[model samples]
Target: MCGRADDHFGPLGWQVLNGLFGYQGWELESMRDEVRPTDPIRFVRRTGAGFEAPFGRWGLVPPRMTLDEARKFATFNARIESLHEKPMFRAAFQAQRCVIPIAGFWEWPTSAGVKTKVRITRKDSKPLLVAGLWNCSQTPDGPLESCTIVTRPPTPDLIDVHDRMPALLLSRDIDAWLDAPPIRAREVALASWQPRILQVTPA
Candidate 1:
């Protein structure tokens, strides 16, 4: 599960996401250096009109869940294997797929103690376009949007660090992953979690 990330990209980072995702509508003013579940983070989603940059809570909060209840289950990362079957993620997986812009992510190895932190990033130093699902909820204040990252079994390179890793979309496949039907999106997602060229170090 990706519980933490480095997101201090600022406006320039948003530009990078827009360029990679081919959307000119991401309108976030700033980003945080460290992001956690429930924290507001910028995500890119394709609307009927086109792409929209919306700041959403990192953890998915289904319309049925109250903000407090949403905290009980770990909704930050949804397993790709059960995304379609899980009630909490099914709808979002089918229609609200989005991309999470991340500079890097942190994980703790099973063999390591509680204090261990391993930072992983692309060898090319590009931002990771993580596959995610999102939903909208009606809160007392207003409508709240939240999202969850999709994860698959780890690639050979990352298995020692964690049993699962975020489902990643290649720059070329971003369109299909975000706009294709559910079946096609799954295919694109499976193929996109390829042999990775990663740089991992202790954080």
Candidate 2:
């Protein structure tokens, strides 16, 4: 999330994201996207060729209706099994895919009025690249960005608490998902969550 994350780094969050691969804030001034305090932070994809900045919101708002309609689908997650066909998300699946990196996520379970939250992380506790999709829209207010994290069938360990989990990508798939003009659904899954293993600890 551009503006909605805990990993923010003052005015240089953009620098950190773009330079994450190697530069380490080396290309700080090149990115033109402004930081906003919201979900889905925008950043530049610095490739061997150059940099391309895209504006995608943290939540996806598919095309088809008025500005009022967008609010109905500002969801943070999309079920992976149905991404290719879901009316609200299909367009982005083929055209505007993205990558979201996270150290982990929190899940809450409730039973008999008791609620507990557990934090899940990789065995190594490293960051994961969560696959996502996004879109840019124009309203009377000008342009706005949004996105949705794709979710796959939950691991057996997590299924009891939730039926779905974000479709996470391996580092090897980073180039394809974030840079491909169009990514195949099946291929996306293979490059993404198939081998991911995670652990959940009580929060």
Candidate 1: Cα lDDT at 59? 95
lDDT of each: 0.82, 0.60
The TM-score of predicted model 2 comes to 0.70
Model 1 lDDT-worst window of ten:
23-32
Overlapping backbone residue pairs in candidate 2 total 7
lDDT of prediction 2: 0.60
Model 1, stretches more than 4 Å misplaced? 10-15, 22-31, 110-115
Best by TM-score: 1
lDDT of 1 by residue, 64-157 (tens): 8898999898999998888889988988988899988787888877563555778888776778888999888999999999998888888889
lDDT of 2 by residue, 146-185 (tens): 7667777765667765666767777677677666654454
Give the Å error, residue 138, model 2: 1.5
